[model samples]
Target chain A: METVDTLIIVFAVIAVVGSAAGAFLYDPPASPKDFVVTFTEEEHDVASEESGSVSGSTISDTVDVPVPMPNVTALELTVTMSPSNSPPVRANPANAVIIVKDPAGSEVGRKTITWASTESGAKSVDFDIAQQYLAGLPDSVDTRNLTAEEAETWAAGEFTNRTATGIWRVTVQISNPGTVPNEETFAISVSGTATHYHGQARLETGPISGAA
Target chain B: MVKTQAAMGTPEGERGAWSSRTGFILAAVGSAVGLGNIWRFPFSAAEGGGAAFIFIYLVLLLLIGLPIMFAELAIGRKARLNPIGSFRKLTEGNRLWVGAGVLFVGVSLFIISWYSVIAGWVMRYAFGSVVGSYFDDPAGYFTDVQTGMDALGYHIVVMVLTASALAIGVSKGIERVATIMMPILFTLAVFIAVYVGFLSGSGEGYSFMFAPDFSEVDGSTVRSAAGQALFSLSLGQGAILTYASYLDKKESLTTNGTIISIADTGVAILGGLMVLPALAAFGLLTGENAQGGAGALFIGLANAFSNMGIAGYFVGTAFFVSLFFAAFTSAISLLEVSVSFVVDQWNVPRKKAALLMGLIAYSGGIIAAVDGEIMGFMSGSWTDAILILGALLISIFVGYVMKDAIDELDRGGIRGVGRITIAMTRTVVPIILIVLLVLAIKVEIVDQYFASIDLFGW
Candidate 1:
């Protein structure tokens, strides 16, 4: 009986050790492949005429910027209205305006980005621009230069909007610069929304000129 | 001849005196020094207010933990019974008072099921560290090896080892194991602390650990400190009660309790020295995403070992091996609580009681191991809640119910300083513990008040 007890004890120890090994060895299955959106920037020169149209011109311009997206995922494009060259304006109750549309040119989602500051003086604001907002834009949209029509769409979308994909144009018209100085230097920041296959989301942000 | 005869028959009252004073101290210290000292204490310190937490913890240890520990030992020695039996015997066969002992066993068994699983993780990591499996790709290796069947298996191995040791009974088993293991545990802890202290660019980790980030102090920090004081000393659990049952009346409970508390706290501080410095030395402390969970010791230390070159392998192995011993000793105490109860109460043979209790613990442990959430709740929230409640209950029993017997035990001990300390322990300690219990309940309010202050840059 003693020997049997000893043997059982030894077997129990081995079984415990074996199970630990199994736990360490187990791995979850890999996720399935899915389409991903990636952002890239290409610079284009704007004709002088495209820069002058304020509220009704159809001119388009191109701007060069670095791509922030590292992986491919679905895309979301948004347009904001803010003052020219101002410190990045937050979508707040005072001056918050955003418009988003889907690929079929239908409004999908819209919200105001609120500006908040931390004790350390760090500031952040969020706004949503739908994928459909990219539809109905001219074949070539120069983010560097904005026309009156684009500006109106940017403002109107700040309240209402549409959706499209491929190349989308965003225009910013700052209404108030707040306590921050150098309002003209502030450019509208554009970002893309994409969800990777692994359930991680990617976002890209860049400055867009407010020349129009 | 005396040793052999004593071993042959378990004497009801005096059969279990430790072979030496050092054996008792080390055994008690072994119970006190555990994963709580190494991982949990430092995390609490870091989260609570670093240096501020240390100060509060030290105060709590002196004010609350030491007295309750002394009371527990005195009760056990006087009754010459296991926690349940001791309480019943002390209350003159009052059955209701046995709840304190029962609660200790329940909490201990619950703790052992999961604690052994962690011990198994340490065992696996000890081997893996030697092989440099983690050295090649530490993060990926930890993530891969950390969960599932491997963890469960190792937990069971350690649990059975603990149970087998307890089955041999106290003198021949617990005393002998503690004597051999405690020195090794201390040596490794000190060696790691010294080695990590001297590493280049380790100043930050050292400062983070020892320099006291005073900013972390607040009311919640104090409550956590008090809770840790209870845990680090193994106060509320009947382990002390059971261990003290083996003590001869001649032993000084106050002196022993102080020594154990100091040794436990010393090792805990050293463990922080070992972990924080190594982490800081490697600059692995950055990026919030890199912060790990309770398994941080296994994952973090593995990552550190992989980076330490060849020396890292040996040191890492030594650290885990020491941890295995430390954990094994405590695990034995936990298993003994239930097994001893069964043997003492049911009149079952020692070996049979061990097997039954071991089987029950093993099954419960398996369930906990598979479900991380359950394991977490048992170890984290449940253990704290139960320990605090247990400590308060034990205090009331010893302070009021056994006050006269306890006073006589305290008075019979050695000379001048010891006598004064005992008087203070009997009177002052109980009052302070009651206050601590009340303060602990309002800890949330204190935490918010402290958070509003900008001290220590927290």
Candidate 2:
């Protein structure tokens, strides 16, 4: 009985002490971390199918850019559209709008470019989103006045540990279709790179029907 | 303290004794492992404090759950009767003690009344998986069938199945079913756990289940851990006691009790390993996507399976079928507690008692199935209160009041430590149960319910 009593006391003490030690010493699961994630640049080409009477018509294509897909700190989209005609046309103005949406279906960035069409090989427009966000800061809110952490947060802008991480959609819509003497063919290629944090486990979603 | 004079061997009035020690252990294990393990444990651990919650829960199970389990078994084997009969016989027909027995039996009946309804839901899920009925929209399917006439129909189906097993008698029915189903349940659970481990991002499930974040621990966490230990073990309900009553005296209570405890806990851990990882892989483990209780299992996991294409069909079928076996075994034990009482108290045959009690429980289940709120209310704080109160009183009865209870515990190859167990039961067991009981009422009922009404306008 005495041995049993002593054993019981020892066991109870161990349980109590072990629990307190574990409570204080135990480490939590790691939080989603912030890191610069780079995406390999890829060009996707889309051709306009319309030939004659191409005015008032639009041609558009959406592409999926593969990146670490969340908390994007830096992104650059370069759109190059080249149009060719049997007889070259002059001053055929065309408007191009580039749209980017995150996995949550929230539109995060948009850029518009307009140019006069010529028989040139290619016309290029560049959208550097991070610089745009940095430039968008309020005039009165000076970066020098901010604390180090605050400045870092401000620099990260809308990309600080954003939870939306799966798929990113980039769509380019070209309007005011070509006015060539005979027929016109426009080839547009959209390419970009994105930097984001890498920590959270990527979602393993199955391919959806009709998704490219 | 009047000692019970019933013989140490098998008593005359037992419904039926377990044919072998293995059958008894398997049946006891079956009773302990149920929907609580599969549906509730993973989420509870996730919500409580992950591994910290598991640690506290294991401590409570060792210190408190096991002792009470031993006491219940000892009392049952010694008296060799139903809870009411056992109490009356042990206490020399003391009315107050006899009423305690009635409460134990009543708690079993109360639990089963709604328990069968949920068991019915498991059945529907099992069948639904085979037919691929819920694959299209899991959440919508659960909502459509979880209540009303559909729930009632499944509820009746579950009740009839449970009653049929009971009516077949104990050794042939309950033991036979447990012997066969327990192994199958283990195999299916292990198979799923292994299969899901190969999936990408499943490591998050491991972290979610096992990473200890002590900051989440609080008063409610401790209370929840303690309550879960008792609830998961199926202690404080007459089911354990009732099952013990049919045991042969030569079988060691300590050995059987220990095995049952370990087996039950193992099944719960396996369930966590299986479900949590699969949920993480499919990106369904997020707070926004994952729900609590049955919704976590039925809706979230169901949706994950639907996305898995052809493979989901086989795995989903295996998962729900194992769950059905687990639920069915437990529902049988719950029904048996009342059936045993009727058989012993009224000199009724086992078949008739099972039928009568089954019909009554079936009717109560219909009401639960129809309303759903009734099921919630019955399974909530009030049930916790009853279960805790019963355990507290039994500990007191065995430790201080009942004569030769330690002697009974020492029987059947248990040589020593009976006195130590009784001492702990008298002191630490009651104290812990009292704390848990108060916390159960304060947190579950008062805090949840009265806060809404604001009766005192505080």
lDDT of 1 by residue, B134-182 (tens): 6754434443343456666676677768877777767777888999999
- Give DockQ per model, in order: 0.06, 0.02
The best candidate in terms of lDDT: 2
lDDT score for residue B231 of model 2: 83
Candidate 2 global CA lDDT score: 0.74
Top candidate by DockQ: 1
lDDT of each: 0.61, 0.74
Identify the CAPRI category of the predicted complex in candidate 2.
Answer: incorrect
Question: Which parts of model 1 have CA positions greater than 4 angstroms off?
Answer: A1-212, B1-15, B144-146, B213-215, B287-293, B403-412, B415-458
Residue-level error in angstroms, candidate 1, position B167: 1.7
**In model 2, what is the error at residue B197, expressed in angstroms?**
0.9
